[model samples]
Target: MSAAYVEHRPISSSKDTLTDHHVVIVNGASVGGEFSTQLAAKNYACKEGYHPVHVARERHLQNRDIPDHWRKDPC
Candidate 1:
């Protein structure tokens, strides 16, 4: 061990199954993020959907006064 100690984390929802699958979701809403997070916790890959209209609505508060150039991807 050096000056800094390292730690290891066991992945959650370890699985022996190899039946790959995809989950199609609605726009990137809170529920969408939650679903993806849970599936990843269970060892599944995820694909999230995003619509410009939905994103604009969702990020209205965060982008209230910030200039477009300085903001990060609204997704």
Candidate 2:
């Protein structure tokens, strides 16, 4: 007689499904740097099987003092 293996799956709700996604903040002294960092993080998350969402707050751009050199795009 051969034994059959069965895989078990969990029943999850909408809120549980939301847990599969993650939120990350993309912020830096410059726009390019912030964008690059966010992309890197997203790529890493995807590789690990998690959905990454880039999130930013208006306060991050408000009253923020970034130096002239850092404000320039590295590209």
Candidate 3:
């Protein structure tokens, strides 16, 4: 697969915790993974009041600083 890119933007900030804010990813379709997995993570994070970010498969693979488990739950 080619390189993928992911972007994270926080729509709002919370006085309590980072997860208390709202976030969204504009280019979710280009992410190259199972839409369900991405959606599931997105829904799950939002439900928990956490920020949700999206990246292309390429970017995700290139990001060595991000932990493996974080890919599963990015909040």
Candidate 4:
């Protein structure tokens, strides 16, 4: 696959992450993966390249330590 470009507005702090209040969530999917879904499921917004499968996995990883509602649940 060709290189994929992800874009986002300037983030000022970790508070901007969709996964955690302490993490920095950047919008955009992996060139061949699912970083976007992982971020979006937690209410994170991205500009492009969103894969549901990938996002679901990211949500799972992000939720390993938090309560059910505290993290993104698998769809």
Best by TM-score: 3
For residues 1-75, what per-residue lDDT tens digits would candidate 2 score against the true structure? 111111111214333332222222233212112223433534443444433222222111222233321222111
Query: What is the clash count for each candidate, in the order shown?
Result: 0, 0, 10, 3
Model 1 gets an lDDT of 0.23
Stretches of candidate 1 above 4 Å error? Answer: 1-12, 27-49, 52-75
**Pairs of residues at least 3 apart in sequence or in different chains that clash in candidate 3:** 3-58, 4-56, 4-57, 4-58, 4-59, 5-55, 5-56, 6-55, 6-56, 19-49
Q: Can you rank all candidates by TM-score, best first?
A: 3, 2, 1, 4
Q: Pick by lDDT: which candidate is best?
A: 3
Candidate 1's TM-score reads 0.18
Model 2's alpha-carbon lDDT is: 0.26
Q: What is the lDDT, from 0 to 100, of the residue 14 in candidate 2?
A: 35
lDDT tens digits, residues 9-68, model 3? 222234332332222333334232233344554664445454444332322123325655
Candidate 2 clashing pairs, residues 3+ apart or interchain: none
RMSD of 1: 17.2
Model 3 vs. true fold: TM: 0.27
Candidate 4 has its poorest 10 consecutive residues by lDDT at 1-10
Q: Tell me each candidate's RMSD, in Å, in order.
A: 17.2, 19.4, 11.0, 10.1
Which residue pairs come into collision in candidate 1? none
